[model samples]
Target: MEHKIKVAVNGYGVIGKRVADAVEAQEDMELVGVSDVTADYRVASAVAKGIPVYASTDEARQQMRAAGYPLVGGLSDLLGKVDVVVDCTPAGIGAANVDLYRSLGVKSVFQGGEKHSLTGHSFVAHANYKSTLGRDTTRVVSCNTTATVRTLTALQDAELLSKARGVLVRRATDPWESDHSGIMNTVVPEGRIPSHQGPDAQSVVPNLDVVTMAAKGAHTQNHLHFWTVELTRAAEAEEVLAALKAMPRIAFVKRSDGVVAVNSTVELMQDLGRPRGDMYEVAIWEDILTVQGNELFWTYTIDNQAIVTPENIDAIRALAGTVEDGAESIRRTDRALGVRADFTATD
Candidate 1:
């Protein structure tokens, strides 16, 4: 029998819980355990799922024990127990913990919140699968970054993309993050141009020139991208749409399909019984795809809530180099997660 990849996820919030669940579903990956600050309801929920829970720090271990949930160990001990440690902690936390991962000799993957420089490699499996081979740490990148690379790289491979300019409609915080979220129904500008997403995408598809603008949306369900790209060749709208549809994790759906809003897209996922209501794809609004002269324009909403889980799965195998074929890993991960190219699969 082949050895399963022993994986541990740190920070059991939205991203960590999803990552832990994904690791469990992979045929060759075993979710060894999860760690987080001793937040009662969340950690208890992790316990309810039967995921072994651990404290995010030594100081929290006692708190966890006192809270009546069992702990396999603390965060330090978690490092010794797994082959890979996926750091889903808040921004900057993963970079802070890099030395620990090195000292323990465990490969770790960080989420996008950390700077790309934190780890030598920034990853988007479709964009740079082979780049992660034998690397000790990998940053799976943020949801916006994930959507950007998936969208542009698809068009790039077809030689359809010359340059991508997008405005990121970012959600303030997750809906479930109510305790610390609630910006008085504000839509705050991110106050930067060529937003971090552009450079982040370059980390994955290093040669591409993609600039982005960003804004905070009132809703917390998903992030939207309003994109205008210059295509190398003039093509019909249908041809452009077909090219995007061929991308591995991009889902094409339109209002004609009876889904009109991003929340509705999410509700449809929940109604369809998707795992944790995850719409793990670039949900392109199909009708908006248009070609004007040399520029191809469109808008799409990415379920920032759930798009990166499968990528996280692929990142695990990439960092480990345990899987030789990137396509094979993506296919298996998608099927396991029910991530398909159309809305019907969710509906």
Candidate 2:
């Protein structure tokens, strides 16, 4: 029998709670502790779930007091208790903590953000599962990046496109407690947030270079992205649609009799019925793809935590040699979740 790998999650907000829950659900991973500099309902919720709550630092204590959490020591103490630390703090903080986690000899995973890049390698689970071998740190691409890569990898493998260009129109989540949801009636640019999706996915599937544009909005929920691509060959739009529609994690739904719009994709996520506050329930729609015109358009959602945690767990499993490859680890995880992926079956 294999001993379960102990795991700790620092920062118990939206992504942190989800990571902790994901760890608890895995049979090979155990949740050791939950830490936060500024505790709030999330920390209290973790306490309700029977997870240990540590004493925060003085600065953190004051924030916790305001947030209604009984503060704990600074983040350093969370270092010694687990093998992998998933840092879901604000962007700048995670990069700063990377050294601290390394000093403690613990493997860690990072979500994509501007200020930090703690990973030695990145794991897409589908495209680069093999990359996680013996890596001490890993980075899960951003939600937008995840969606784009999945599409780009599929299209490239089918030899449909040689180069890709896309535009992302993203939705902001409800602010930390703002009455006005982020996107009440607004559409904004993602503005140079460097989505490494295009280049990163190109590394695995081969034969494609990608460029992207991003737009952000005030809405606090999921996003609706539009991807316009220039295909290598002029194929029928239906054929291109057929190719994308065939993907497992991706679904192609029609919004109207002949029009593909962002709202159409939003409805798909609505049909998925994922937890209300969960970020992983994004659904995509291939609304407009003009093969004859050498262009394709689509929209999708992103469950940010879903993209990160599984890859992180798989990375640790790869390190432990519990699986021979990333595909096998992903397959094991799918089975655990009552899911089955034909695209990733091992021989």
Candidate 3:
């Protein structure tokens, strides 16, 4: 209803950092400020951008000031100024902050790390964008769930997909955490089928028929998802690529170009001059796409850290009715943030 939604990002870590940047890029929203407990280069970066950085506690304010980050104000300053808060904190922190957000009479968005019951609306703008419309508090589905739901939603929108199964090769930690976050000496399995991702997707797409298993890989850069999405009818590989290509948030990798690994994909995005070195699309390897009867099988790398950034942006728009259509909001976010980051190489 207001001309622009004032948004504060509560955590400045991986997800929070990307969300802040994405929110700043949006034409219809304002980044009121960002809050973080950790005092590091990230906080320093925010200060350098002239973005107000807030500390939630006296100890945190002291730590940030000690680290030479100029403190504009404390957490209450951000909470008081903003219309809505995107709690980009670690897994459980957002859940804890719900009461605080409410006390301030602010709308909020949480990340997928929180339980679905954390809020009435669990959001994937491309999937359940309408569900979040006119809602106050919601959680942008996680990176993995976004990747899966984006694809599944596209297929379902076309009335093509009948069922789906995925084997998620998840990175143990994000790229920044790779130093301290232990690498998998060997692949670690979740030791169970029907990983939470399946249910997470279902939470957004009620009719999505998906089952997933997960394993942790040694590196922490991208998450590779191998999905077998069965369509209602047979289709060619080219048709599959076209279907995926037609989807807004999907970037079809036209060629392998000797780029076969997830790390190399990150390098490619970097070399292509991706903003913040972020890869916000599902980079589907089109050359490897296959079709057998009514099933389409493909592998795509989801930049686990950055792919969900735009979803948060769109979720914000949905909450504000800034864009009435979910697809339009997704398009605006993709265009602003450069989803897929580059398309000159695609055929």
The lDDT values for all models are: 0.86, 0.62, 0.84
lDDT at residue 145 of model 1 (Cα atoms): 93
Off by over 4 Å in 3: 340-342
lDDT of 2 by residue, 1-347 (tens): 67887877777776677678777777887888878765656677776778866644576667766766544445667668777888777776788778888899988877666322356565566677676667777776666676777777667757786677776666566346456445556667654644555555554344557877777665554556666677777777777766665543554444444325444433433444433333232345445434556666555555544545555566667655557666667766544543322212231
Q: How well does candidate 3 match the true structure in TM-score terms?
A: 0.95
Over 1-347, each residue of candidate 3 has an lDDT whose tens digit, in order, gives 44888999999988988899889888889998998887777788888989889998798899988988878888888899988888988898789899888888888999999998989679887777887877889998888999999888777877788999999999988767767776668999897788999999988888889999999988877899998888999887776666676788787675647667787778878887877678888888877888999989889898988888888898888877767888888888877876752354552
- Put down candidate 1 lDDT per residue, 1-347, tens digits, no spaces: 67899999999988998989989988899998999986578888999888998888776788887887778888878889889988999898888899999999999899899998899788888888787887888899889999999999898888888998899888788878867875667789887887888998988888988999898888777888898899998788887887887789998878887878788788888987888888898988888778998898888888886888888999999888889788888998988888878877525
Off by over 4 Å in 2: 55-77, 114-117, 175-177, 180-186, 190-208, 236-248, 256-273, 277-282, 286-290, 304-309, 319-321, 337-347
Tell me, by lDDT, which candidate is best. Answer: 1
| Weakest ten-residue segment in model 2 by summed lDDT | 338-347
How many residue pairs clash per model?
Answer: 0, 22, 0
Q: How many backbone clashes does candidate 2 have?
A: 22
